[model samples]
Target: MTTNRTVQTAADAALWLAVHRGWHVLPLNYGTKTPLRGCADCRAENTDHTPQTCPCLARGDGALCHGVWAATTDASVISRWAQRWHTSVWAVHLGASGLLAVDLDTRPGPPPRHPLNGLPWPADEPPPVDGLDTYATLAALSGGTVGDTFTTDTPSGGLHLVHEAEPGRWKGSHGKVRDGDDTVRTGLGWQIDIKAYGGYVVLPGSTSKAGLYRRSSTTTTPLWRPDWLADALARTGHDRTATPAKATSAPAPVATGGRSGPRRYAVGALRSACTELAVMEPNSGRNRKLFRSTTRLAGMVAAGWIDRTEVETALAAAAGHAGLPAGEIRYALTSGFNRPLPVPDIRSAA
Candidate 1:
């Protein structure tokens, strides 16, 4: 077993390793995913729930804040933080740092096998090999040898598979695989969480509440995203497509019609439209803009071109990022259908 001091040393080394390698890092609590509390200035700025225009990010110095905005690669800034918060764990900002971490958790058991066993864990299973099945499946799907990619064993008996990711909109998922009977299985199972786009992961040497994570002896250069892995993850609903729908791509003009005839396009067309709208600029009148976007999106929805849930989910993310109030965001998304858009004139285009 690695001692606490050794674990601490490993974490420090890992921080410097990532920093030297050009990855921006964030300081998290020693044993938690939560980012360390924001510095006084950031906290003061975020006091209100209203959409904020915090200067920390714009300043580009990477001073201090709780979430993704705290990422930085400056050695001096990191040294200062290291001195001030020596016990802090390192969490790489996934999307911003150009890294993707596959967080594989152990499949917790139903109840304690023994009376003295307080936690609900599989009694028969050995202590360290809990998530092997899931890990093996990912390894096979990820198109790499055991030592060909960066990997780590989490302190709490889980795993982290590291991969290099291009700077873009890569989505992540906490997905599960299910058998015909719908019994959830491993590899896309509930126990796995792909940490990407708006997520972070603790590096080797970081101590979690459970214990310290240590890197395996087989660390290697991180590889670019693999095709097989991408498709599997996408089908499992945890990945965003490689090509983001450009915000400039407008939806197909709504044709005059209703449920009266077969729809001109499938749900895919609407999905594409929503994707484009999602990446559009969140202007000053974000509410009005969202309302208008939703209006166009819902037009497709009314014609049965897309599912409401999908449209709502996509638009909600955009609205939330734009700083719209929760109630207003919801209203903007739902109200579009109430004022249905006129179907586009297919003949006019001809």
Candidate 2:
């Protein structure tokens, strides 16, 4: 009698590989794409009006509060988690890992006509999944080189285009774009989503009930995001011009000529902070909002896009204007900067 067999890589093995590659990893539940839930304390705190400001997150304690916030490149920690849950799938936090991904859900068929211009693909060749050809056309129109960008194929036969997550860019969800009027519109047509900051994507070599993820026709590493793609995506989400101007007093002046480039970075921090604050309810818990907003700002600092002190000054003024108390704002900003994140290679385009 013959036995049926196939090679299968272990989940932890995937984690080990990703962590070694400098990607900060997070754990997904066994056989599912969802992130493992936060600890009991974090769960309880979610009931609060300001769930975003969970104290456990700011403390840097042992509790795994926000799953994305818990992403790490630490080999020991990755190995420990892998050992604990052999079935856990591997995921890389987008912004923390300095990577971004475009999710394209497609189906086998004649590819749809370009949505914007209604041009058809060449009739002689077998068409790619629906919507993908459209995206390729759009990317080309936007002056991007989509042909060589690293990509992955999902279990159900969709595609993921991986690129560097540029600082000062916003994330999108399931093709939804939030307008300045607080309305939502369909962006990237109907089948694409841009996952950037505050997002995560499953790594290749991970398995689930759906199936395994595999690299799609890519031999090169993921590249720096093409500016055209970023610009096209920015229109779909919170672009710099889309954010409301801060009504708060100006931030304290920062010294010039440091490694962090305090003054220059502060402008980006303020712009990012204003985007966060503009969406919140005016009376929401200041600490929670501060923590959430500062996380992004601190990432800018950590990425060498800005200075830590610059972020601090900008956030303080933003928080104060939003009615958050002085002490709590300080605590939240400090805790946010102190929180763990993947230290990125600012110089590397990959």
Candidate 3:
């Protein structure tokens, strides 16, 4: 929907463009990236109302109640929000819009001594000074180059490389690479963050305290992320879900010490489920497959044949590899865990 001629503010124009491009948007506080707070009643410290149950939200009178969850593409909502928060900055919910942003920030202070530690960096080349350099080095390492894309310049002199992604395919992650001891190693170099599922990025042309976020690319169309880059990101541990616990050792056997049949069956079933999940296409019944797999494995968990933590970690990894968003994966796992356990016919098991 076209923005009314009376609403000629830069924020309004950005909101209109984002809505036109099918992006879900919400208003942030003026001169800041923070989402506008909820209504007075909702903001009360002792209030019992949640965003979902708030009367203001139900009546469509509170457009900025739940942060990104309040984001919508409805013209009326956008107009109302723009009118109410005239100077507010507009932000796009990247995942809801099937978009991803590589946020390359410019940090103050001297560069790290060993930014790209393991990567092959030429002795003649200068060390990376910012996120752009880090991304370039990472791209080169992956045998790919940072070609043209829909790029934006942040007010703080950072870059946002906007790319198109399949909906529910990726989740947000910071650029921190950790070691076995949980030591921090290099990640996407430094100052780089991913904004995807469950995250949002400010709209271009919106102004913040530092300055305006301007479009740097000639085209508005975003390019698909290169396969090599995706692989590198996976290797570097981006777009992954955090596991609750690590499986350091095999789960202790259940009390039926003499009977190994059910345990063997559960192990085999878990392996099969993970294998199927890892190979499924992102949009081709992946969610349903995950739910079924989780349900089956959850049955094994209930039977005391496998450790619940192990099952969760393995299934989450497989689902993440298959490009399922973390939120969706968690939902599937939770739903499966709540269902009644299936009776395993273990007559043929070892």
lDDT tens per residue, model 1, 35-92: 7765566664555622136666666665676476577777777666666766536777
Using lDDT, give the best candidate's number. 3
Measured against the true structure, the TM-scores of the candidates, in listed sequence, are 0.55, 0.56, 0.60
Question: How many clashes (backbone atoms < 3 Å, residues ≥3 apart in a chain or on different chains) does model 1 have?
Answer: 7
Q: Residue 237's C-alpha lDDT in candidate 1?
A: 34
lDDT of 1: 0.57
Better of 1 and 3 by TM-score: 3
Tens digits of per-residue lDDT, candidate 2, 91-196, equal 7778777788888877543333323221222335454445575577567645676756667788887788878756536665664223332212344543567777
Pitting candidate 1 against candidate 2, the one with the higher TM-score is 2
Deviation from native of the Cα of residue 89 in model 1, angstroms: 1.6
Error of 2 at 294 (Å): 41
Q: Which segments of candidate 2 are over 4 A away from where they belong? A: 1-18, 44-62, 107-129, 176-185, 217-220, 240-350
Any residue pairs clashing in model 3, and if so which? none
**Candidate that scores best on TM-score:** 3
What does the lDDT come to for candidate 3? 0.68
Query: In candidate 1, where is summed lDDT lowest over 10 consecutive residues?
Result: 111-120
